[model samples]
Target: MTESQRPRILIVENEPQASEILTRWLEAEGHECVLVSDVDEACQQLEQDGFSALLADIVIAEKSGIELVAKAKEHDPDVAIILVAPSEDHHKVIKLLKMGAYGSVMKPLDQDEVTITVAHAVERRRLLLDSRQTQQHVKEEIQARIARMGEREEHTILRLVWAAECRDEATGDHIRRIGLYSATLAEALGWDQQQVDDIRLAATMHDIGKIGIADGILLRAERLTSEEFAVLRRHTEMGARILAGSEVPMLQMARDIALCHHERWDGSGYSQGLAAEEIPESGRIVAIVDVYDALSHPRVYRPAHPEEEVTAIMADGRDKHFDPRIFDCFLEVKSKFQHIRKEVVPEGVPS
Candidate 1:
């Protein structure tokens, strides 16, 4: 390459003689060279200077050059790293590549070979950097758009759940209470923060399919006939179908909860009749909270069951109607459950 065309390089080596030889040869070949004797100084110059590539000896003042390569990659993976080592240090050379070094040169130090190898590594680094930057930019934009769409979906689901509640005498507090109850159950079961949040938001929509039922049937003051009960049971399947094909995880959980919340642990549930662990974890969680909320809150037909009755019924359903392990978790947080119910009291509704 011509003097004006050759790329600049920073050579980091503690051996003064080796550093001088490398610098003089590189300069003669029309490349600019900056020599540094320590990793700290090399790092500072690498950060502040615009060099095309770095040629670093793997063993510098008792520090492994592989460590330097790893640290440099963390700072800027696009910066090419070439480790200079002895031929016998093949294991170290292999390790450097695994640590993200661009390439390696042996100690015999062929000046002509070094120049060509460095040029190739620099070109490869440039192309990779450009591609990575473009991918990052595209990923960021897509994530932002998905977030906005998710927010809109949440608002729509809230409005739909509220509309369904309009058919029954129960206020919006019932839904919000069930949401908090489910979230607490999930957290007690060792779910992470994101999973707990998803359960919270999604559980509020568990009764959304009730919107499809007629108001007279929904608000009947007396017990439903067997035939009417069968019709109402279809709400689980309807809710799942409404939310199917969504890419969002929270909506997906909501769909699962809607469909399987009525499912029994003993394989006696509806639709697909999935039982035990076959049920999605989200649905299992909602099942416990849904029943608890229904018992604690008054419906158009039945008055609220006492807290003792609610706890007794849940205990009975432990192995048959709900997951046994999650049931245990619920029992642990039963006291907090009532607190949440009180906290989510709907607008204009009495505590």
Candidate 2:
């Protein structure tokens, strides 16, 4: 290698004669060298310079070469450190090699052999550094792709909700609000972040089954007869059916919320009539978020109620209509729900 192409090396040797010999060998081979007489100056030079290789004595000025090697690594983990020791201390040489010293130069240093060992050490460090950079680049690429997929999934879900609302009473804001309310309540329930995010998206589809109901029944502004009411209840089962048969995690959760949101805490609600603990928690959480949003917002058959009335109505259902624990969480964050309500209130509806 030419002088400009060779690795920059720092040589630590307390003996002036030995330091001169190392400098001559490396300079003869065109390797740029920084000569330090002891561990103190070696440490100082390491901090101030960028050296690709280090040729340090196993003991310099009564200090451990291990200390200098460790410090050099802290400055540049990929820096090659070669220890100089006597050949008879083979055990020590093995130990130092295990501690990350690239290699060792024997006491009877031959100029040609010293240059060869330094060259090998620098080449090994360069390969290790290249491998680490490649791994980091691959990791970053994987994260970016995952982020893109997540965005696409969210877009498809919102579009599906919008389509469902085209002929029903729900709005895009309504679905988004359901997701927000569910996430808040789930957080209070001690769910992990992934579970909370899943519920936030899944709860938005609680009324997706309304997509299958006839226009006369689903869009009616008047109270329904018992016959139409029974037909309306079918929306729950139909919603579960429509959302079933998928391995997609959020969709599976959406199916559960759709089917059981109408079920009561006391086993008196609709469709499956699951009692407390019998229903999935996803369904339980959406049940509270759905009814609160429904009663507080105007429905096709009723006017919007005040926040006080909404709470009173919900509180009445605590142990009967809703899960006790979840309902308690709802009470704590009811203000957030109201804030969402005001934020997305329909254009003509008064706050």
Candidate 3:
């Protein structure tokens, strides 16, 4: 990379006299030369060591020197190859160049011309290597920056979720359980790691729109009248609006979960009334987990239902309230769901 550094050259010539001449000329010019007689020796040297330029005679034993050019390239595509030969045919030279020979030197090699050509080829190789290293460094830096941005976005989302939880102390454990439950189901459903992680964080924000609802409706101990229930339903649309139009993948997933978590598989749920697969998979997944957690835990309007009763309630809604496949996956991992609920539910509180 530096001007003072000598270029390591691999000289492949069968004839001792020609090999000596090239070696002395290149060495005198301050380049380090490794002399090898045939293609086999050249390939061995190329594989064992790194070389900046390969200067090979056109005819090497029974094999053509053009073959060495390809072999050297295979060892290191950035290596420069110069063919030394007797033929002056333009077409032959073009063929060799197309085969990846950097340049050709005539049989009665002129010392000045050979030196200048090898010098140029070696310089070109050095530039290419430097450029590749620079590109790699830039790529690594970009990935690091993107990872940092993802971390920052996750932190911001968690803070907002916590702020929303402050509106109702009783719902704090509910939010945590929802995240764990969604992540576990997503993993069982064969979602990739990124999707599982995104859904975990995004699921926590499903009730974020409650922050915008008035305390009168959100904290009411009595069941809501039909007219008031409509206002409560608006929270879904409001949550979607709060999280919409983000470029972040997690936020986008959060928006979908927030908007459609209440939608039913039978097209009977509020807001969009999307049926079956018309709803985003994230929404469908959160819906089952949300309802299960709500039923298992005590709310102002009702006491916590027994686990048997909760299971029956969920089973009754199978195709009507939830996606069939998702409901099945939930059943398969229902035990894990119970474990997570017990682990995350706050102390002195019944789940």
Best by TM-score: 2
lDDT accuracy of residue 295 in candidate 3: 91
Per-candidate TM-scores read 0.56, 0.84, 0.78
What's the true lDDT of residue 1 in model 1?
13
Least accurate 10 contiguous residues by lDDT in model 3:
342-351
Task: Encode model 2's per-residue lDDT on 248-293: one tens digit a residue.
Answer: 8888999999999999999999898899999999999988888888
Off by over 4 Å in 2: 1-8, 21-51, 61-77, 300-303, 335-351
lDDT of each: 0.80, 0.83, 0.85
In candidate 1, position 65 carries an lDDT of 66
Cα deviation in Å at residue 97, candidate 3?
0.8
Name the best candidate (by lDDT).
Answer: 3
| Error at 326, model 3, angstroms | 2.1
**Which regions of candidate 1 fall more than 4 Å away from where they truly are?**
1-156, 346-351
lDDT of 3 at 91: 60
Q: How accurate is candidate 2 locally (lDDT)?
A: 0.83
Cα displacement (angstroms), candidate 2, residue 340, comes to: 5.0
Which residue pairs collide in model 2, if any?
none
